[model samples]
Target: MLITKNIKMADVIHMNYFTLSVLNRFGIELGFGDKTVAEVCKIENVDVDFFLEIVNAFVDKDYFPKKQLQTFSVKLITDYLRKTHYDYHQIKVPEIESLIEEMVKACYSEKENLVLLKKFFNDYKQELLNHTNREETVVFPYTIAIEDAFNSKTLDNSVFDLMETYSIAIFQNEHENIEEKLFDLKNIIIKYLPQPKNSENCHKLLYALFSLEQDIIDHSRIEDKVLVPKIREMEKVITKRFGEKK
Candidate 1:
């Protein structure tokens, strides 16, 4: 699909399911009164170029531009990510968990199996929480430090020491593991679990699972395609600057 600034926000979302989450990052609400992307962004005071780059990235997985990333700020990316974490932990995850409980109570005959399913979900939730916490505490601060050091034109050799110990590579490696558990959770619901009596509840759970899964896939793409490359380039610059001093 052609993604031009003239395209309506609602039309773009209809064209691609992923666009909603991307626009949500900029706090651009839907029902845009049929306003084009450019119009909505202008009203919302969002950066048009950055918004277009992000929207196009989701629409076309291979469309990431390193130069465009240079124009972008790490803080902007992280703030979006942090809000995504809030959506998962504080909102989406709990909504799913509550739905699962309702399904369990509604299907008293299958309480035993439903209880096990709830346990599995709780486990997944815990793992997700742990992963986001690590990003917020460890990974994000290090990224910000790199950005600050680069901006200040101060070569802090100490930051390199931190990089050596806990780098982006380490975080990237851990990302797949977090995603795998979510996959397992989805599969268990689709294949293994018996259909609850209240089919509506089961459908609700499945819908939530599907939506969350897509959101996470898009989230991971941003990290891998956008954030990782940006930080890696920054790392190269910092390493070269420090190497010249020796």
Candidate 2:
């Protein structure tokens, strides 16, 4: 007789607003980890085979499968950013620049207003620089390492332990800080940065800020809701493996 230990099911928790929104946008159904194949089949109104297939698809894409309703992976943080934040900035930054230029043209007729717009752009430029630098230098690289470890099939307990504090926990706090800063910019754009009602240039600037804010919000949601939880779950895997070894 051959014997193999059974892997315990992961726990699935309730879906958050951000996760639901992302699922809707992607036309994907949410998978619950905590439930059994039969249970998820009942909840999702699908058969066991179909539910199992969907879960497999998520796993194929390096997404954690919710077993027992608790599914997570550290790499999910990087994956979410690659799909959402990186993609957003790749498109939004150019759009933002165009909008800023339009505002400059509208303010060209007023020298004083033109000067103010220049300063405003400078401020926003600096903010973008700081944000991108942190992601590139610290956040993205760590995530890439996690993903690489996973793909190479060398992923093990140590990586997960390191990530528990560095990538998962620290990054969660970082997302909160980033969200607050983005919120600050939104308030400034809406209430203080623009006199759009009085000037065409100001109007263009405010619109650009509004669009940028939306993009930032989407970016934040992916990191906070999807990525953080994934990392936490990976920690669980590490614990499980350790227990099994012992």
Candidate 3:
């Protein structure tokens, strides 16, 4: 069911607890006693429609409204994406690391493989972090500038110059196939590893890996499908005017 503003804030949590991260990222704190989703969003000063779209997409895998998402300001979408990066770094990544550490400890035989497994995960983690860093430092800011300059009555030559050198297409192409690396890690644990001494920890470790993998997939879809195209359109408009100016 698509979440709407009139839905009670607590009921939205009941709809899908995964939205806890979504809510947290929006800077919506708890203790919004009896407030509807719209009321809480208003108090927190969040865009209610954007919040609903994000939450609905989170709850239902098939519910991403790409056309609608593109309608939002770059700052809104990028701000949410930045918060997601923080969630991955400060929370999800560390949680996965801890699970791996536990699995390594719980492996009775072929412990050496788990050590190697740790290395594999760390390499993937580092690659993902580097990708996130690039978006934070480079892609997001450039896109925001495009949006800003596109909307302004007078254009900024600096924005146009920067656009000439770097395009959103570069960011789109740079999206690495990290999912395969993550799938390999899962296969190693499921197929290759000996029965761990603590089977529960092994199960927990696998579950964590799966969860992070899914989250990354969803996150990438938003960037590749929505954000990049929006920026590309803005680039086209700017490029046309730039050609006229020249």
Best by TM-score: 3
lDDT of 1 by residue, 1-246 (tens): 658889888888889875676777688887788899899999999988878877777677677544675568999888878988887887679889999989878886868999998998898888888888988999889888888877777778788888788777877887765667667777887888888777898888887887777777767878887788888888888888889978
CA RMSD, predictions in order: 2.1, 11.8, 1.8
For residues 72-165, write the lDDT of model 3, one tens digit per residue: 9999999998998898889888988998898887676888878888899899889989989999999899989999989987868999779778
lDDT by residue for model 2 over 144-233, one digit each (tens)? 556555445444666666566576577666554444544665566566653544465556555656555655654655455555565556
Q: Distance from true position, residue 154, model 1, in Å?
A: 2.8
Question: What's the ranking of the predictions by lDDT, best on top?
Answer: 3, 1, 2
Q: How many angstroms is residue 16 displaced in model 3 relative to the true structure, after the best TM-score fit?
A: 2.4
Candidate 1 C-alpha error for residue 186, in Å:
2.2
TM-score comparison, 1 vs 3, better candidate: 3
TM-score of each: 0.90, 0.52, 0.92
Please give the TM-score that candidate 2 achieves against the real structure.
0.52
Off by over 4 Å in 1: 60-67
Compared with the true structure, all predictions reach lDDT values of 0.81, 0.50, 0.85
